[model samples]
Target chain A: MKKKDVLLKALKCAFPYTLPILAGFWFLGFAYGYLMNVSGFSFVYPLVMSICIFGGSLEFVAVSMLLSAFAPLQTVIMALMIQARHLFYGISMLDKYRGMGWKKFYLVYAMCDESFSINFTADIPQDVDRGWFYFFVSLLDQSYWVSGALLGALFGDLVHFNTKGLDFIMTAMFVTIFAEQWMKEKRHFSELAGFASGVIALVVFGPQRFMIPAMAGILALLYIFRRLVEKMWETGEDTE
Target chain B: MKMTLWQQAATIALCSLSTMATRFLPFIIFRDGERTPAFIRYLGRVLPGAVFALLIVYCLKDVSFFRYSYGLPEAAGIAATLILHKWKRQMLLSIAGGTAVYMILVQFVI
Candidate 1:
């Protein structure tokens, strides 16, 4: 296939996978932009932050951080904590992300939850270029978020609509991914451990600081049961 | 708003830097040719399911059981997503349906 044909085929394959994210990111990004607009910042903040940070939750948190007294150390620490999950994503993608050369950098840079989930799970057709497929997925998802944030920041005051529960798109997306993962794997230990540990951490640490503890708990539990979990997958008994 | 323009820029830059650190650290630690540690490779295999679960919980971290809506809209929305996904296996339909359900419940019913 020609280079353009391969790129076009990859983009065509990638677009369908990103449609859900398009809706979710636009709604959430618009909300972030609108919030920033009302908080007295110009459209520049969202545009730059969305492009730079690219993590939706952290960018939203950064809005509050920006509003508060300037504390660069706190800002860095908070950003690290909020985005710690990307560490797992990076590890999981280490092999797959290799060998892409320049595109590898953008893949890791724009490794938001939606992009990571789609790139990791989507089954590219045999003829499609793997690197270009992943690139389009990441690029399209980022563009949706950036455009949404730009729109919200620029025309937030002009828009008037009831979008009270529109943010649920994200939660729905995550839930669907979780469910799909559940069905794909035979062993439920990791999934169960994650759910139980997450709930426990949330209950113990409260919403303000549950992520670190939850992640720690997950790692510890997964490590402790490493032999057993690996055995389950190895024996093939864990499958449905 | 309280910070000067430079301070605001510094803070945003720090945020971008810190976020980049987390995303890049693993690849940096285990360079291209070096053998990744066995335990780390094990983690790569099993960690995704748990991480996805954690992300789902993370998204819902702000919900309050004792608050005004009592988390009903979230619960209903998730339930709708579960059902829709289980039935259709269509990603867009499940998300759109669940979000629409939540929007309605919060807008009028709840």
Candidate 2:
């Protein structure tokens, strides 16, 4: 990949779809920053966390864990469990990730859902360089997060803004992703079934148990109805 | 007591440690791992919706059915969001727009 092309791909990855992620990075960083400042930590709290511990939820939890004096081992366990979903991502991404160089470690390290989601689709143009693409994606996403945190920590005193509505971005992002997937598959049973099962589980189990059960249910449902799912899937592909 | 630069750095470093822990599966990117197993593919298939659904609740966990967050307007904003998201596939617009509407309601109507 020529230097020129790499720059181009990095720019391409920066705009459009990445905007939502950037927004998230901003708010999450800002909130983390506010919390750190109020909780009696310095700017370094948010900065180092953003740069190194880019894990979304865990970072928030980490703040309280420190204030409350949690054991390091406990924090480690909690972090692993909270982000355990990434394990699933690793399994699915094996094929796509199989051949990079030194960048491989960082790429894997930076494998958050946002990056994975973006990468899951879009033809990784043979002409474009993967490393540059990954670098931009990782760098931009991290920047959004870190910068947001840093900014929030520095100027939190002056700001009295309400965050009442900001959290919806996560929900909105997911809806967008799900809708896109639905559009791609177009009313396929497996997709619909999974979605339906997930909703039902949400209502029944409430929020706490819904995710794991619903995910497991979807897989089982697909396996049970493999023939029908395949038929629908084939039909979907044919239409495409 | 005010935290020093190094202490802040180290403390946040501890915090960031958890993030890495979650993201910390040892396998290198683009190497060594075989095709995603069927189970993982299954996890991927359902995980998005399931997780999203949970996030919706988590975000609104404080909003009570018997009561409202910032009152009726904020409540309406949420419903408007769900409707707009479902009706029009405009997520960013719906969320931002819905939030703005909620903010307005809280500011003026409430």
**Clash total of candidate 1:** 0
lDDT for each residue of candidate 1 in A131-222, tens digit (9 for 90 to 100): 99999999999999999999989887787788888888888988999898888887788888999999999999998788888989999999
Correct interface contacts retained, every candidate: 0.86, 0.31
Each prediction's number of clashing residue pairs:
0, 3
lDDT of 2 by residue, A128-225 (tens): 66666766777777778888999989987777867655655654555556556556664456556555766676677775445556556666776787
TM-score of each: 0.97, 0.76
lDDT at A194 for candidate 1? 91
Positional deviation of residue A206's Cα in model 2 after best superposition, in angstroms: 6.0
Strongest candidate by DockQ: 1
Give candidate 2 regions above 4 Å deviation: A121-131, A161-163, A188-228, B1-18, B21-63, B69-95, B105-110
DockQ of each: 0.83, 0.32
